[model samples]
Target: MTRWRFAQGVAALAAVLLLVALWAGAPEAPEAPIEALPIADVVSERLTTLGSVVGLAGSGDSHAWLGIPFAAPPAGELRWRPPRRPEPWTDTFDALAYGSPCVQLASGFGGVSDQDPGSFAGDEDCLYLNIWSPRFDAAEVPTGDDRMPVMVWIHGGGNTIGYAGSFYEGSLLATRHRVVVVSVNYRLGALGWLAHPALLAGAEEGEPKSGNFGTLDLIAALGWVGENIEFFGGDPDSVTIFGESAGGKNVLSLLASPMAAGLFHRAIVQSGAVDTVSLASAVNYTDEEPPGDSFSAKEVVLRLLIRDGSASDRASARFFAEGLEDSEIAAYLRRKTAEEILSAYRDEPDSADIRPPRVIRDGVVLPHRRLLDLFAEPGAFRGVPIILGSNRDEIKLFLSQDPAWVSRSLGVVTRVRDGARYNFVSGMHSDLWKVWGVDEPAAALSRSQEAGVYAYRFDWDEEPVRMGTDLGMLLGAAHGLEIPFVFGHFRFGDEATAKLIFDEADEPGRRFISDAMMSYWAEFAYAGTPGRGRSGGLPEWSAWGSDVGQFLVFDTAADGGIRMSTDTLSTQGLLARLEGDTNLDQTEKCELYRDLFEGSADWNQATYSGLGDRGCPPESLNTARSD
Candidate 1:
């Protein structure tokens, strides 16, 4: 299509949206029963243009109307803009095959090819949501009854990756827990988050005026659920928001955002709850100084636009902005191709754009400037029940990405980038040094004190033989590994739990861990504790505080109860010395420091565990021999 024609088309689309959104989300009918199943007990059949698919598993009884459109296809002029509710669909749209994933570079193989499986089938017109519930198993609920709680899930992808497809589906959770499961697809990477000043201007007044369009899209998705979920046998009154990795990062942001208040009742943050690790990845990215410490989303958008198409032409951007009225924006975007629009809104974000990822603190979502303050405020959040935990060796996967680690698993020169690498090895020394001197723990403990906190550290690595290599040697309790154990759904494709990432001694290894994890997850979702069903007769856990940092420790041994480390206190004390202001730990800034340049690779001879036991810094092992 010619540029002028595209421009005209876009102008028309935007005009229509303004009128519609002003009147969107009117009340809808209670869902009707669609289908039933033994595995799920109940299913709601839905038909979309793509085809027919059924919504299964609500809190015992579920009501479904399939083919619901969450947002207008982010086509043509609407390409780089914030999402809009679809101009009401006129026909029975199919809801079976998940719509294409949002377009972007595929996930990193990182030598774990079979394990990662990267992303598949994506496009710009990808704004859809799926919901499930155990309640669907029941045909009816008494009127005026708020029986089931709701959970809206946002998958993790470093702000640029992840999928909403059923392959990573959460139906089992719905069937088992009898809660509403809502999984959604939002814009990712440059398309989803790049924030330019132009975007800042277009935002409406009084209703979440800001720059990060991707974050707002999620807000829009929740807005839809808040108004429509009750019809599907859900209780909007009490909702628990949850996710792992990048998803958990978002849970913190939503908890802080005033707009998200009254939208959820409880939350679950797994494998990632504290700040600093990826704290830079969250919200409040309004830093406009000469390339400051925090990331600036607005800068990324402009740079991407310039690199791709006519974004460099300030005049064209202004033209694009002016024409954003009526249905022109959405219509024009739909008519033009994704590749075509990609040019003006480029890809391959430069270094600056990539750093400022998911869950940014734009003051609106996270009013408290820092992590501790956000948690400290009583009125900031409703202080709901929370499930937060991590894997024992969360970084072990990356450490194993070294050549020696791969050689053991494959029994050959595998695809690792370098030879003989480990997180506590030479190349990883820099990251190791940073952790030793950091002190964000006190702030995190503060959050625990403010809310109902449940914590755990997963440490499961089985041994034996596999491909002539001990898989157990490759990992401990690394990031994202806890997910499968919780659901007992380890094998994603052909690879089983034992084969995918481990060399199990026997099949019992997978079964034992799976059973334990699945039970824990179900019990938590059911009753808010890992031992919710009263099956395991274990010690009662007391919530944590700035003073008492009690936490659950899941180990290879079944009876691996609680583990405490005084090291945490020392770490907190050291933090009292960096370059920030906080009662938590404010360090004085010094112009000169000892050994400013430490050879990272020096730690090849020392292990983190070895250093801790030998009266050395638990982190010094990240460097070379230090000789």
Candidate 2:
């Protein structure tokens, strides 16, 4: 290991050794006091938000506190309702290990949630947030000048499943960028976001009666941060919101949500878009079936559950009481298994009334329809600066076929026993469809408020994730690949492409790029622009659409990383097919377009789930070759 890496190892070892005394009420060691090492200092702390917050404060120019619950557990009767303020406690709650992730089916989530095999399990009490704030310099204090910018994070799992523990560590960004960082967890799956007519009718003032309940949880956390971050020495007004994948989508949602206005000043969205759920769907929220012929969130859950096994009151009761343990719940779950319990819920009387009918046009929270449509209409948000990009091989996580089959499968087509034929595939999978909009994020942002937009493409993957094949070979900086580079985490890309994906020339490569990222992010937080007027030796990035075809490629290759095009986005084409003016509604349109999807005779659904045309067609002025 390099000297810095060795230092890291030693620091971690020391941290492990020191954690014993940091535990609340634990005895301090009797060893003689030694001078502080190069490592940062962290301490345990209890903060009061909706409830008593047990948090840890790490030292540096900044400090971080981990795992503070922002909302009440979604247990029992509260399962489908919007999250409430966690019940207050008289004692300090221990914010030690990241709390359990909310209970989710784990069907679609891959990278956004914990990718670790041995740590962090998904649970009911998963509505917590983690905070990282740079130290307040005495100069910035009221009498002392002590203040730094803050950036809060919201993890993404399609408003279903994700946690605050993985894929993000605010230390590097916090101290290096001289800013505060925060990551949070929210409700997910059937428990976190279930919008029903009955629930809507019961909506009280200040509560999100319909549409997005999980979104409300995020708002509450922001509110909590606004109130408490000052205690940790952060500037409350100059906050930025950022995340990757689903978390990016959450940030955008917050931007439009009335409840989230003024909570953040700047934003960074890595691979998130608005065209995810078509505006057409049906539900069984009431006694009878919903009045549409389209597939709805509620209907999808009901059918999936019934198919999964929820067939009667016992099953229904089990599914409803899933993870709801004042006591005995864990035993029941252990006895039945998660699948069996979920199956039982499906078998219930109104399983169809479970989740959101659809992420419909909520004028209050979303403030607009079709994410880009609002940009077209203008005034969708506070018009803050945004740093948005996607990985070159973002589709890597979606590589489903065993690696052994990759080479042969690349250009050839085959028919399976299910009478399904696989075509030459390229891109992500259906599960990705569960969370991300198929539209290229670049295309989506082109039509949005475009002033502060910064875009990038991630194209790196180090090791192959395929259990049976070198699937990574096919994924060139696939989805979310740019994240590590942006955050200065280089392990996310391919060993072959690392230098190309990021500046890998030396320690300065990591430090410089990280510095650039931090400065730009901090600059955005400070003054709606990156770098705080300092270039950080990085190239300038420009906005897209309406001509001026300019972009800053993030690759380290001496290609100047500059490209321009206004014709790569075919969002209109994709939307037209997904939700068109035809008499057919979106689901019907999709059903009709089924011939063009995965198992169809001519198309490759596994990797390339797009219109026959790719992004950025030179022939079209409004599209690009990448689109």
What is the C-alpha local distance difference test score of each model? 0.46, 0.48
Q: Which ten residues in a row have the lowest lDDT in candidate 2?
A: 1-10
Q: Can you tell me which runs of candidate 1 are displaced by over 4 Å?
A: 1-68, 80-82, 89-93, 108-121, 135-138, 141-146, 205-207, 273-358, 403-450, 493-498, 502-512, 526-539, 558-627
lDDT value, residue 319 of candidate 1 = 52
Native RMSD of candidate 2 (Å): 12.4
Candidate 1's clash total is: 65
Provide the lDDT at 367 for model 1. Answer: 55
lDDT of 2 by residue, 54-159 (tens): 3444544555566677778866556555777777777766655556666544321222222332122466667878776554432342212456677887665444
Against the hidden reference, what TM-scores do the models get? Answer: 0.66, 0.65
Give the true-structure RMSD of model 1: 13.6
lDDT comparing candidate 1 with the true structure:
0.46
Over the stretch 1-627, how does candidate 1's per-residue lDDT look in tens digits?
111111111111111211222223212223545854323123454333333344433223443332245788775666556667666554434444445567543432111122222223257777877776544333454225645667677765555555565434555555555656687777765566543344444555554544345666676778777766665566767667776665665676666667777677667776443332121332223342223223333333333344457355645644553455534433433454443333333223231113324444555545535544556655645566666665655554444433433442223323333333332332122222223211232234345445466655566756343333333544545556666565445543223322444444535665665565555555555455555333464444445545555555555454453343323323233323321222211111111011212222222223222322132233332132111
